[model samples]
Target chain A: MKLTILGCYAATPRSFTNPTSQVLEVKNHLFLIDCGEGTQMQLRRNKIKFSKIRHIFISHLHGDHFYGLVGLISTFRLLNREKELHVYGPKGIKEIITLQLKLANSWTNFPLLFHELNSKEPQLLFEDSAVMVKTIPLKHRIYTNGFLFQEKPGERKLLINEAVKYNIDVSLYNSLKKGKDVVSEDGELIENHLVTADPPPPKSYAFCSDTVFDPDIVPQIKHVNALYHESTFLESEMDLAFPTKHSTAKQAATIAKLASVKKLILGHYSTRYTDINLFRQEAETIFPNVDLADDGAEIIVE
Target chain B: MKLTILGCYAATPRSFTNPTSQVLEVKNHLFLIDCGEGTQMQLRRNKIKFSKIRHIFISHLHGDHFYGLVGLISTFRLLNREKELHVYGPKGIKEIITLQLKLANSWTNFPLLFHELNSKEPQLLFEDSAVMVKTIPLKHRIYTNGFLFQEKPGERKLLINEAVKYNIDVSLYNSLKKGKDVVSEDGELIENHLVTADPPPPKSYAFCSDTVFDPDIVPQIKHVNALYHESTFLESEMDLAFPTKHSTAKQAATIAKLASVKKLILGHYSTRYTDINLFRQEAETIFPNVDLADDGAEIIVE
Candidate 1:
């Protein structure tokens, strides 16, 4: 699993900093989260393949989160894309997009499916054999949601050298790799554990942004391989955190400490502060494994 | 008169090139036409005083034509702007924007007025003492209209040096500038032509884009100071122009020639071609005073 940060600034799009958006690659799927203005350009800058994006998850209806969505969709149609796109967002996205396409008289040749999310509780938005995505309820000024990407359990690996020395039949290798006991020709029961070794551990990532520090989300994102939380303000401006429903570096670190995540990545900074190292310093004071999320930064889960 | 091309590339937005958008400065008034994505950034790059922009005219509901409008409006509110913005666009723009704001529970502090154009026939949408913008009917996939921005006849100039040497009275100067003879305080009739000269001939700019080569609009934009028309295809690809409701470089020049326009500016080139000089050459074959539109390219009409 890997996460690529396309943009991380909060509020509005700027020349240097962008709004909220990212690409999360899990197993075989690429998920786009929270497309802001100039997001398509940012994606091109970061060398992201547009055709690989199959599923999109939006947090809320704020302009900073999803204003670039319509343009991206239109570009897809203009490129004569035939792949089907699945969109999951809050209510009103469907009407806003469909109405524009209808007014312009430019309908897509492909299929566009929208799943308007209006529920208040955590729910599963997408799931497949390799990965599953569940919504993590967040506290914001409006109806919002964060995504959790979890990888399914992988199959065990077989030790080829051990299997050859033990004279294991090639036809029974599949069953042996699945942790099954096989009966030999002499009616002797052979254990599969001796021939198979452990496979790599599956990793998961959680994305939480444009929200205040809510301790209740600890249980939902517990033990995630990586957690990306918004740090819109620094410790000096912590007073503005509660009123704006945003999180400061210290507050995000506190949540990271409470959740006990594997690693903490901070992003969605305010434009007032030019030096971003202050965020890492403030976060590292409480959470030692915290890192600042910069544009084009990639984090690998291993 | 000056024209600032913000984004003129056709189809979609890229990391460097942008989509269809421009700002025309005529008679000390800033009029924006067809705002696309990254337009606010383009305005910043061009050093345009965005606060002076009080009127925005959109040709159609295509995302590239008007996706940046909501972000621009939101930025105005953030800047604490007090000017009342008037937007003339196709129908459904108001509903799409207002509904998004409603869902986010954020409303603008300044006044935003909307003039939805759903009519098929040509009509006058806005007119002031210095400028008049009338819709020029065009053939397109959508209900698109071309905008003719003509500077109203300005006040006649007083030829300051000549008037001073002739000892013209201040009161008579004002009347002469209005093209009327007035009796001086010395009981002498001062002729308007003797004291004042005609003001620099009022100039005009006609913007027609996202449409095919429809001769019906030729008379509406005839003999303007300058014309910026869309050239989405090259002469070789004229076969594809009719199907897409777009025009080739030669076709656009044909209309410019028939209308007897002084200068023709070709833009909105298809993204398939990397070299844009061909478009200029193609149009110049028919119209000598032709130029290609590039990002941040300024055209001065004197």
Candidate 2:
């Protein structure tokens, strides 16, 4: 799985900095997460194709989180996109977008689908044979949700040499890969494990942003391959974090340590700071495997 | 009068080019015109203070024209602005912006006054001691209005040497600057023209965008010092201009000539063109003093 940070800044978009927006490429799916203002431009700057994005997940209705959504939707229409577009966000997102479209009188020619989410409990948002996406309910100033993307396990790998040595027929190779016992050409039963190796472990990534440091989300995001958490402030500004419903770098690292996530990526830095390395320095005190996210940065999930 | 082009391209905003948005600094007023996406960032890039912008004029409901208004408004609130903001646009603009603010629950602390307009004829929108703004109805796909920002005549320049030669009292200088004749202390009648020169000719700037090749607006914008007109297409693509309710460079030049505007500024070019100078080349065939607008280009209204 690969993740691209299109924009990671907090609050307002600046000339050189952007707000919250990213793209996760997993299992042949390109999921756009939290499109803020100037997201479309960031997507263009990152050289990401606009048409590949089929699903857009918005965490909340905050301007910094979803202001670019309507513009992106309108651009898709201008590009003559015909594929269905799915938007999953807080309950009022549909009304906010539809009203703008109504006023502009430029509705999309393609299928525009809106999935308004208001569930407080964790719920599955999307699923297919290859991937599953679930919501990690988050506590914020308003209704918000973080998304968890998990890749499904692949088919078991067949060991051709071991299968040949076991005298298993080639036609039964498919059954062996499915982890089922198959009859050999010599009429002997062959165990699936004897001829096939287990597939690589499935990768998972969790995106959490614009939320206060809450240990409650640790259980939901536990043991993920990669976790992206908002670190709007550092330890120096700890007093301003909770009241604003944002997380400090140390607080994000504490959650990462409690959840045992394999890797913790910190982002959503406030523009007030001149040096972003301070966040990494602060988060490293709690979690050793911490990575700082910047605009246009790309990460590979292990 | 100074005009800063924030984003002058037509249609969707791109990585380097922006949609329609510009800042006109006239008579101590920083007027934002046609705020598209990425406008606030552009304002920052141009080093224009957000608090100085008390008035915003939106040409239409097109996404490219006003998508950045809500974000700019929200950013104002974030900056703790207490000054009232006045928005002038079509009737539906208030609903479009208010709904988004409602959904985000981030209403502005400052007074946001919306002047919704639905007039087909030229109507005065704002008037102060220094400036007067009126609508120049434009023909587009939807209800749209261009704005004419006219600088009110300044106080007459009192020729100090001439006033002293006439033995006029210093206390009467204010009245002399107001173009009034005053009786000299020596009982001599001094003519206003003898002591004071006429105030500089009132400078006027008319902003016309996203409109077809309509001649109806010529009279309203006639003899303006500067005219910023949309030239979304050149003569080569003139076929696509009128059908899309846009004006070609030649068409804009023709209107400039018809209106007898002092200077013609060609902007809102379609992003498909590689060279924007072609717009000036085309417009110059019909009218001289044509300036091509780029993202950060600044023009002084002569």
Candidate 3:
């Protein structure tokens, strides 16, 4: 799995720093997350193919989180895109987008689907043979959700030499890979574990942002391979974070530590701070495996 | 009057080229015209003060023309702008803006006034002691209007030497500047023309865009100092221009010639043609005084 941060700053997009947006590539799916203003330009700058974005996930209704969505939809129409697009966002997302398109009198030529999520509990959003996506409810000023993407475990590996030694027929290879015992040609039973090896463990990624320090979500995102959490303010501004329902670096680190995530990625830094390294330093005090999310930075999950 | 082209391309904003947006500064008023996507970045890049903008004029409801407006409004709120903002656009603009704000639950602290324009004829949109703005109806696929900004005539410059020779009292200088013949203290009538010259001809700028080859608006923008007309296609694509309700360079120049404007500025070029010089060449064929509108290019009305 690969993750690319198109923008990570907070509130508004600056000339150099963008707002919140990212691209996650997992299991043949390119998912766009939190398309803030200027996200289309950021996508182009990052060299991400526009046509590859089949699904979009908006965490909340904040302007900095989803303002670029309508523009992207319009651009798709202008580019004559024909592929169906799916958008998973808050309840009012469909209304906002439809109103703009109605006013402009330019509707999409392709199918535009909306999945309005308003569940308070973790709910499955999408599932396929290769991957599954679920929502992690978060505490914020508004109704928001974090998405968890998990790759499904593959079939067990086949040991051809062990299967041949057991005199197992080649036609039984599929059964062995499915972790089933195969009957030998001499009517003897062979255990599947003796012929096949276990597959590698599946990896998962969790995206959480624009939320306060909430331990309630820890159970939902536990043991994810990588976690992206918003650190809108520093520890010095903890008081401000409470009122705004945003998280500080230390708060995000605490959550990561509680969830026991393999790696913690911090972003959504307030524009007031000129130095971003402070966030990493503060997060490392509690969680050693912490990385700062920067625009165009790519991370690979092993 | 100063005109700054923040962006002047047709349709979607590219990595390098922006969409349609500009700043017209007249009589101490900074008016934003057609704020396309990524206009705020352009404003920052051009060093244009955000606070100086009080009025925004949107020609139409096309995404490329007004998609950046809500983002700018949100940014203003984030910046804690206390000044009132006025937006002029098509009838459905208020609903579109209010819906987004309602969805985000972020209402502006300052007043946001909307002037919805649905008239099919010329109408006054804004006016003050120093400047006047009126809408010029245009022919397009959607309801559209081009704005004509005219500077009111300023006080005539006083010829101090001539005033002294005429023995005009200093207290009556203000009256003379208003083009009134002053009565001297000795009961002598002082001629205003002999002591003062007529104020420099009031400069006007007409912005007509996203329109087809229609001569009906010529009289409304006639004799303006500068005319910015959309030339989305070249003469080679005249066939395509008609159906799209867009104009070719030659058609824009034809309108400029009919209107007898001092200079013609051609913009809103389709991204298909890379050579922008071709637009100027084609426009200058019919109108000798033609200028091309490029991003960050500034024009002074003399």
Give the DockQ (2 decimals) of all models.
Answer: 0.73, 0.83, 0.74
| Top-scoring candidate (TM-score) | 2
Error of 2 at B142 (Å): 0.5
lDDT by residue (tens digit), candidate 1, A231-271:
99998998999998999999998988999899999999998
lDDT of each residue in B1-302, candidate 3, tens digit only:
99999999999888878899999988889999999888888888899998779999999999889989998999999999999999999999999889889888889988999999999988899999999999989999999999999999999999999998888889999999999999877788888899999888899999998899999999988999999999999999999999999999999999999999999999999999999999999998899999999999999987
Across residues B1-302, which tens digit of lDDT does each residue of candidate 1 receive? 89999999988898889998899988778999989988887898889999999999999888889999998888888788898999998888898778777877888888999999989888888888888888877788888988988888888988777666566677577777789887766567767787777787778788999899988888888898888899999989989999999999998999999999999999999999999999989988898999888999998965
TM-score of 1: 0.97
The 0-to-1 C-alpha lDDT of every candidate, in the order given, reads 0.87, 0.93, 0.93
Which residue pairs in model 2 clash with each other?
Answer: none
lDDT winner, 1 or 2: 2
Per-candidate TM-score, first chain only?
A: 0.96, 0.97, 0.96
Task: Return the TM-score for candidate 2, rounded to 2 decimals.
Answer: 0.98
